[model samples]
Target: MNSELEALNSLIMTEADGLLYEKGLIRKLEKYGDVFISGSYFLQLMTWRDLDIYLASDKMNEETFFELGKEVSLCIKPAKMNYRNEFIGHTEHLPKGYYWGCYADFNTNAWKVDVWAISSKEFEQKQQEIEKLKFQINVVQRMAILKLKNSVYNHPLYRKKFFSVDIYNAVIEDNVNSEEKFKYWLQIKRGLSLN
Candidate 1:
């Protein structure tokens, strides 16, 4: 287990010399079966040109979306010790886990032998978090529905999957003051629903 953990730490972390991972973290993983990984969506959202660029990009096809999703899930799953998200359980490419990566871009690595006697406990907790995110996704999904219901932009049909706030912002930028552009967005950060 220690060697596997050591191997994983080597594989995922950046090539920067020195211990990318803390010794204490590995010790905890040996007992906890869970270690958070940073450099997550929040970091990307804050630093990247746009929060939803990858999700909003029109260049990708259905296949690419699934692939990216799979890569992301695999990157995060081991840290959370959620093997279900490793393309092992369902055989479908959906994220069943969320592991908070580190804040620095040190490119810290993971240990393949990351074993915790209580893997099941960690997995259940991670699964609950993923479920919460799914619920949030369903709620925001209404924004896409509104775009279609009101015919707010080109390809109202295509916008069905573009549920991110960044995408809404992009559309608003493209069609300045279209009839469907609700004025309330200016006042509220999250904005309000139109009647």
Candidate 2:
């Protein structure tokens, strides 16, 4: 791992720890269901202050989920919280569950926390995908991913025109090793031109 990437990841992890444990976010979440941290944080490829948390429950209803949201609001005092009931109206490329998109200031940094309430089955399915990526990622690919992620973290097209999965695929599957190569890959594969 690049020394710079390692240091940046460490700083982000420390902030994440403060948010999860010190802020009692995880404790509050566990009261509702089994909480599983995922995404960049779990993959240890964090380039920004974002957290993906999933609450697995065999039985979860809207009322209970709202109650959970209420508790989360009181705990985190988020700047804004967006709710999505995907279970009722599932969206493409999204899980079928309740979601809370929490935007908050933690440790003097703005953080985006995605909290999902899904069935254990759904959680398991997602975990399988993450594990596959985890297994396929070698040190070289990890560094490539980290570099590409860092390069695009603040780009105009970061999450709007492209996403982390595209970066991962470019590096892991298409062998994209630099920002220049990633730009070309995006243009060829997704017809997206950054410039």
Go through the candidates in order and give the clash count of each: 16, 0
Q: What lDDT does candidate 1 reach at residue 85?
A: 26
Error of 1 at 72 (Å): 28
**Tens digits of lDDT, candidate 1, 140-186:** 34344234323433433322433334334533343322334433442
Global Cα lDDT for candidate 1:
0.32
Across 63-128, the per-residue lDDT of candidate 2 in tens digits comes to 998999999999888999999999777778789999999999987899999999999999998888
- Model 2, poorest ten-residue lDDT window? 86-95
Q: Which residue segments of model 2 deviate by more than 4 Å? A: none
Question: How accurate locally, in lDDT, is each candidate?
Answer: 0.32, 0.92
